[model samples]
Target: MTANPTRLGAIRTIEASEAPAAFFDVTEKTGAIFGENVFSLSVMQKRLPKSVFRSVYATIQRGEKLDPAVADIVASAMKDWAMERGVTHYAHVFYPLTGLTAEKHDSFMEPVGDGTAVWEFSGKTLVQGEPDASSFPNGGIRATFEARGYTGWDVQSPAYILENPNGNTLCIPTIFVSMTGEALDHKTPLLRSEAAMSEQAQRVLALFGHEDIDKVVSYCGPEQEYFLVDSAFVNSRPDLLNAGRSLFGAKPPKGQEFDDHYFGAIPERVLGFMHDTERALFRLGVPAKTRHNEVAPGQFEIAPVFERANLASDHQQLLMSTFRSIAKQHGFECLFHEKPFAGVNGSGKHVNFSFGNGNQGNFLSPGDNPHDNAQFLVFCAAIIRAVHLYGGLLRLSIASAGNDHRLGANEAPPAIISIFLGDQLQDVFEQIAGGGATSSKQKGVLSVGVDTLPDLTKDAGDRNRTSPMAFTGNRFEFRAAGSNQTVAASMVIINTIMAEALDFLATEIETSVKGGTEFNAAVQAVLAKVVEQHGAVVFNGNGYSEEWHVEAEKRGLKNLRTTVDALPEYQSPEARKLFTTYGVFSEAELESRFEIGLEQYVMTINVEANLTGEIAKTTILPAAVRYQTELATNVSALKAAGVDADTADLLRVSEMIAALRAGIGALDDAKATGHDHEGLAEAAYYRDSVLPAMLQIREAADEIETFIADDLWPLPTYQEMLFIR
Candidate 1:
């Protein structure tokens, strides 16, 4: 750790062989080992009797009740399979209200006669476990001394094996609840939401002459974007370690401005990390599909194939955890902060979602003649109506302190939740609303005016990256989510709201048909009504533009720009009513979540502010002043020697030092006021006032870094961190 200015620069361009080998171990029998590490459907089929397997499948597929008798047999089989995989312990993995995964491990060993040990896992153990609830954030749901909480097995999501340096263990996906049976985690509400949506969606299908369709599940494929910085750099930067973002680093002379990093070749070290992560994910039955360089330096993205929302969310958590663990082995740090760097593009989780039957038919798939596919149009209208009516909930679903820096920034989607129906769908909606006949259009060919990309057949609509919620060919990509978030929150909101919309549509259609209106005419009337009422949510313009904000206001779209501003919507009367009526969340549960969210917002900013202040005072200020003193001494020595002492740059550096001191004082004053965390109003005040002061200090310090001799600079720079493989 010698103070060499070029040490980081020298290592930045290391040869490919210098990096670790890609993790392709052909000796491991990948195909055979795939899902060998998971207690998946195949494992269940082999372990359980035919009757038990059928019962479990029914529960997973049709949302039917699990048979009490079958639970023991299923758990016994899962336990045996896990033991064969060298798993001595089991954990109920859950997602808490804090928006991160939580787990508590217990050994499978049970005491036998004569002090002998027997490895056993019982149905009771697999089905439920009690953990202390008071230790976790409950938003006043539980008292401090109330230590009772239950974790129930979520049979819908398959259990997976988690391997660590110490050992391997079985990880069962579970839903956490309070002792009094109140939802205490993100998963329980999500599962409830899924069930609610299925009930309503079945009604819609029944109206369409598909009475046998028992369940309709929403599916999601979230494209996760993240940054990987060298471990040494991350450890050296206190801001990043504490806040998961750079609080003071200046933008490198060369940032993403050249646009050379986007879709660039994957660096060898990063490729090794990705390989290892994908291998682990694949073993866990996660269908990880795409991996490639993203828009910023040291940034990459991975997308999985679509699956049911619950399973997808479970896999997403596993994927993120696996990435971090694998990165540690590769001597790197994976950063999921929405904006890890100031000048580079921030990370986002683009959630591609669609509804489908168990038979794998996507309901959103508009056939060649989208206008003629009335079912597709109806489903699409359901989403539009849901989004329009409950845009606040959708916005609140992705709200967080980390995301506050990314959303509404030029690179990411704006905070205003609007749908991008694309040109073709927009036209179809207009025609349907205007009571005009639908027209069919053939696919068009795309030409790049070059031979690189073959003339490929293109879909009817162009992709709009700027829109918050864009409808791709078959699914809507909800791009508002931060890279670090679990997919459960967004999925729950989408599923629940869509369920409410569909239920309304079904009721209206049933009334119309019962009143002697023809089926087609009634369907058309409902579509027209939906377009007239909720079409304002469909916006295809550039969401990043200021003009669009004004236009959105005219369109009556709610713009919730920050976590503090957006989180209150969770407790709104309309939102509470929507969730309660749909059986997604009780009013009490919704209120609890609102408090938890607001508290999280305040705590996140408070921690960041404190860390920024500490770093500036203890590390950055001393280094800058020491460098300034050296420059001043050199100027005086030159003057004494009767040389043409040119101190212009040195004087400029001195002025910057003064400005840095002033900025630090401002931070001190802001901290002393202690106005932050008073409530929502004060929390917003901190974001608007104190947070800006902290940034100002960072700006002055960053300016000083550029001027200081590289040897004297104490902290790692963006160039050092970003360019490193």
Candidate 2:
């Protein structure tokens, strides 16, 4: 019998595919539609009374607590604005530990003793809602019988309307927590960490003679990389649907070796998808700025302008959801898995991070001459000390089973957490370490040989794409974050660590000033001390090189290469003290996160191992056996007809079929061991035993795919899925 026609039919469907109807022209309506769906400050000002507006504005812009007395007025205004835009229901949207957006919706209609319903959104309803706690992964924060969780309104993040063809819902970004007011979502810790960072940052600012500063915020501009596959192909691939990646497909003949796909022209269909996605994002007030092809075929990237970390986290979730929704409209499936395909460049979200208030601008900006700027040097030194002291936590923040496939694979940053200060900044820091820095490197002008072109300004140093954290002029880009992960976790760790570093430096400077040292002298002394003690984490060399790994080990940097290894860093004494000191996370919350990380890792591998075995046994093996029978039958016919037949194809296919069956048995055996262990031991077993068994099965299946006839192949080939679109 022949194999299923799904793969070939999918190819035909793609060839006959037509572009969806055009969304509104973005260039013409960018300004008009931007933030139109969002119930922003401008909307509140128009709807609320003068006093009410002032109270709400103070909470949003100044990070002040919202006055409870004004809650009713604000809720009424918000409901009226949303209902005007066709919103019949409202949802309190929260980010749970699952790293996905969770929301519970309630209709605005209420009965007033009549058949008809009236719209009612009171202050009490707007401030909080209850969602089942046990249903969500809480790292054992709640038991099965205890199902109470609260969603509290987050005044800092703005509310927006999400559109649907059937109806629209007003979404209020909130924080999820247990009944005792412990954080159970990503947003709560993120917000708490921001407050911690701001408090310490303000203390440092006072030493620079600044007073009464506004609240400081960490800003993030995350560059999201993903691949677009035709929906038909995605539907046919079981591994892609279940595991979010290809478990057995062989590499295509043409990969990203030519490097021609980088920044290449976008496909017309994908461009239409982008237009629709950007249009939706604009209405939600997400400032998506750049779009282009990535280093691999079918891979693309979108970058947004920096926003406050809390808002950026919310917008990042919305951005991903929007992409997924809009891609379906254009007949594509957007994949955010870190490595969706084998032997290709994986996706990563490079989070560009910096912190400052509106009055002070970016604290990390070195300006024209960094050596002469004492304030910038202090902030820079703070980052160095923070990253050096807590490199393991930094690594653990981005660790996940999905990211493990990408990290240390040469395309992404290696597992050793290190900072890359470009040549200019490296020179200035070196000078500070030796004594007082006297000079800074300046940018040079570039001249094209062709006289017709204008002279270009060149940066002081070349960028290292391999660096995990690189200081690009203004901000440090965290290149290790997975494309599918929430940026909040990374921000939480960064904020908490920086708070400790800043507090340390600020106290030292204050103590020295009290000891009769000059203000400028005190600043320089603290900066020098930081550089001497914590400068080992700074590296200007290639992070992908083997030599750098050796060098890092020599410098005493811990290389946590897997999720099992990295997740335990959360329970380290230093991590506990840092989070508890800053009040970002209680010990219970910290322990909960560690358990959740291990649980998620173990579950991820278990699912993948099950899928690999099922697909190999049910799909790959059958296809291989069928092809082997055909080859054997052909040889029999040729010999019967008195003609010599080549037996090479038959022999190879038979060997692969045997290997596939044996590999499946081993995978099943490895998976059975998982029941015998629990927690870290279980995760370690999946990593060491189950993962290797799955790969063995994949090797046999992929090898068989090369020999099996195309029509007999059950799954979609990588060549078809990757390049057909």
Candidate 3:
């Protein structure tokens, strides 16, 4: 006699209601509260002895080995600071290859015979610790029975306090390794790659007559995008909870079509959430510099200032964790999936990267006269050669189940990797290839046509949103990284590739100079060779266009359109040789990573398939049938009552009932057959067969959704979920 009304009703209530008033007071001075929870360099300087602090600082800055003699003093100082801040426990935090942060906490208190406790922290414990690493995904490095793994302190990232409702814990960033010494985590390889990259970069700098060059580092400033939805909406859909995306929702009636949502005013509820999130980030010493509404309803973006790649990677993990934890407190579920809702803009973490040592800033920066700036030209040429040689590996770095929904979607960059140097550099490089470059283009100032507004100095070129990698004024922005990923993989791959390319350039120049050739002639000769061989990867046009894709294939560029197509490339002979030669990864590690990527893809599709079959049978099929029966009953009653009624509704419901049954049967059949194979074959079955069947089911179910009355609909509509604020 009645239909349950909860999903839609809850959404309606939230939509019509105003946001809750602030439950807590906010501090106005952000600087006053900043770094309060972090054990930063300043804190270490104040707490440790002068000699110990200087030694530690040198190790941290130059990536030198930590001295054993100083660990005791440093540990004592750290323990005192943590205990003073009411911390009773400490954890060694590490990054596992499963794209997550891992930590095991230990208490600081040790009981004495006199019924008292003493807080103790030792240098050995601070430097290294053993954890049960069998459970972590090690890619066959350690068997299930062999569970030993080590965690070594990463002094580059600072320690910070993580608070719970009851207590706080000290979290020290560390690198995790398997028992056989293979890297079981992303940080270890990333750190190694950084060291290799810096050595080669130093040699290249010496050729340009720059002495006293410090160790170089790759910097990353990632811009994160995410969507926020009410917890009620998220929990109601089992697919969302299990798959981190909505597996079965019809396209919303109005979604991002007018472009009004981009840079739109923040909703009151969302503003409060942003405010609290930023304050928490600042306290953790995460330099979150920008936050704004993005190009879709309910989507937002947060960007931070650039930092060293190692610290940046750690901070990214902390940032994602912070977003999720804080979202729960605000009654929201933060969606980091590449595409949560259909027919809306997906989220991507645009990673801006560049390299430099302490003496010179930003080697990618094209100075006022880039043609005359030999140093910038050398580094820029190195990047071009690296990308051309390793474009396939770059694609593999971002391969994942979630990102497959975003890349090549027209709104984001295509699967093809290319460099977008601005017009000014493009012209210079063209001149260099032809013979030599002359003068450089300078930026011009423009008036706003109003006396009150000042004139703006516009850059020589505009930013390209459609390129996978675009050269911003001082950095290259990699726009294809999915939102949920750790930045380690992308940066590591970039560093290794750059290392190889830079070595090639340096060797050629060195040999030429030894042969009694002029240095200037040697530099120009190398640049000309680089442009002639590797210049095909540079493109300034729209990457999403059809013409570019066709032209790219003709130019011999790879178009790895999906994870399945691209993941296998990671084990290619060229990729393996590059990694091994540079000491970034061994062959076994490469094989393991490839296996992990394939396994993840297969499992992800399997879950979505199972949920699709179950939801269609348990929820969708019954709903459609009940509505069909109701319409039949009404039609029969009208005929018995001798009143004519429209037969159109009855016919419509019958068609949907038949389609739903047929779609569900097809999906069940697909899942039953696709499981017989393993490795790439099994992944292929899911991609080619099962995924298509799942889509068919969604198609029929969405058609049924359009006809069902609002009260009888089992799932919340996209309109309500997206626009309900």
lDDT scores in order: 0.86, 0.92, 0.89
lDDT of 3 at 42: 95
Residue pairs clashing in model 1 are: none
TM-score top scorer: 2
Candidate 3, residues 245-353: lDDT per residue as tens digits?
Answer: 8878887778898888888888888988888888888888999999889998889999999999999999999999989988877778999999888789899999999
Highest-scoring model, lDDT: 2
- Model 3 lDDT at residue 261: 82
Residue 599, candidate 3: C-alpha displacement in angstroms:
1.1
Candidate 1 residue 229 C-alpha distance from true site, Å: 0.6
List, in order, the clash count of every candidate structure: 0, 0, 0
Ranking by TM-score: 2, 3, 1
The per-residue C-alpha lDDT of model 1 at residue 245 equals 94
Model 1 TM-score relative to the real fold: 0.96
Q: Write the per-residue lDDT of candidate 1 for residues 1-725, one digit (tens) a residue.
A: 32645444434433222555655574676577677688877778877888889999999888889888787788788888888878889999988887778999999898988999988788888899987789888888899999999999989998888876577889999999998888989898888898888888888888888756858898999999999987777877888888899998888878888888888888877887887887888788889899999989899999999999999998888889888888877878899999999988999999999998865389999888888888888899999999999999999999998898999888889999999998898999999889954685567998979978799898777899999889999899999999989889999999999999999999999999999999999999999999999999999988889999999999999999888889889878898789889888887788888778877877788788898888888887888788878888988999899897788877888888888888889888887775634667777777777888888888888998888877778788888789865
Q: Where in model 3 is the C-alpha error above 4 Å?
A: 1-4, 12-25, 113-115
Candidate 2, lDDT over the whole model? 0.92
Residue lDDT tens for model 2, 5-105:
87878888888999987666646668999999998989888889999999988888889888999989889989999999899999999999999999999
